[model samples]
Target: MEIIKTAIDGVVIIKPRIFTDSRGYFFESFSQREFDEKVRPIQFVQDNESKSSYGVMRGLHYQKMPYTQSKLVRCVRGRVLDVAVDIRRGSPTFGRHVAAELSEDNHLQLFIPRGFAHGFAVLSDEAVFQYKCDNFYEPQSEGGIQLIDDTLGIDWRIPTDHAILSEKDIKRTKLADTPLDFDYNEDLYKK
Candidate 1:
């Protein structure tokens, strides 16, 4: 596997080696040892999957400190535009975002650390998205920034009329109004 760093401090893109034959293709999606050597030592405790139709947009979401999560995400079927936004206070790239096309075709995975907000938009007719999180879900700790917040200026790669969003997501606070618990501590990335 090859890991590519993004402009943000802790976000990265991982490309796995694929072996192809007459029948099909094969790749090691995840290996504990390889992951630890390439990325930080994050003990993923929960795995989640979601299937969505085209135009579906989810996120700009993160959890508060003490329940913050680090994730390894990818699209296993169809395609999606995965996005991560830096929300750590005092960070150089705070509020900046990295958009990656994760799909079955490219087989790329994104590593999103705890201090960022993450979300994705389905680009294909349908998609199966999966992610591994180091922390368990905490309903009370959930928080998010509006996906369409003008300050962020994200290009979801889909037309506004075609985008489908949850009512809760449409009503999320803007980044400037959201309360973030993370500070730009260099040591935070050392882990």
Candidate 2:
């Protein structure tokens, strides 16, 4: 696997090696040993999956402290425009975001560390998105920033008018208005 660093610290893009032929393709989706050596040492306890159609967008979401999660996300089928936004207070790249195109063809995975908000937009007819999280879901700890927060200037690739979002997601507050409990600690994410 190859690791690609983003502008923001602690966020990385992984390109896994795929072996293909007439028989089809194969790749190691996750190997704990390789992950521990490349990315930081993280114990993923839960795995989640979501299926969405074109123009569907979800997120700009994160969990509050104590329940904050680090995720290894990928598009197992079809394609998506995955995004991660730094929400760590006092970090040099606070409010900045990194985006990558993940698809079954590319076999790319994105590693989003704790203290970042994550979301994705389906770019294909249908997308099967999967992720491994270091923490379990906590409904009460859920928090989100508006998907189209003007300050962030994100181009979802899909036209804004064409995007479909849930009522809860559409009602999310702007980043500046949202209350966050994370403070950037260099030691915690230096890896």
How does model 2 fare in lDDT? 0.92
Against the true structure, what is every candidate's RMSD?
A: 1.5, 1.9
Model 2: lDDT of residue 149 = 88
Give the alpha carbon lDDT tens digit for every residue of 45-94 in model 2: 99999999999999989998788899999999999999999998899899
Residue 50, model 1: lDDT of 99
Off by over 4 Å in 1: 186-191
lDDT of each: 0.92, 0.92
User: What is the TM-score of each predicted model, taking all chains together?
Assistant: 0.96, 0.96
With candidate 1 superimposed using the best TM-score fit, by how many Å does residue 26's alpha carbon deviate from the native? 0.7
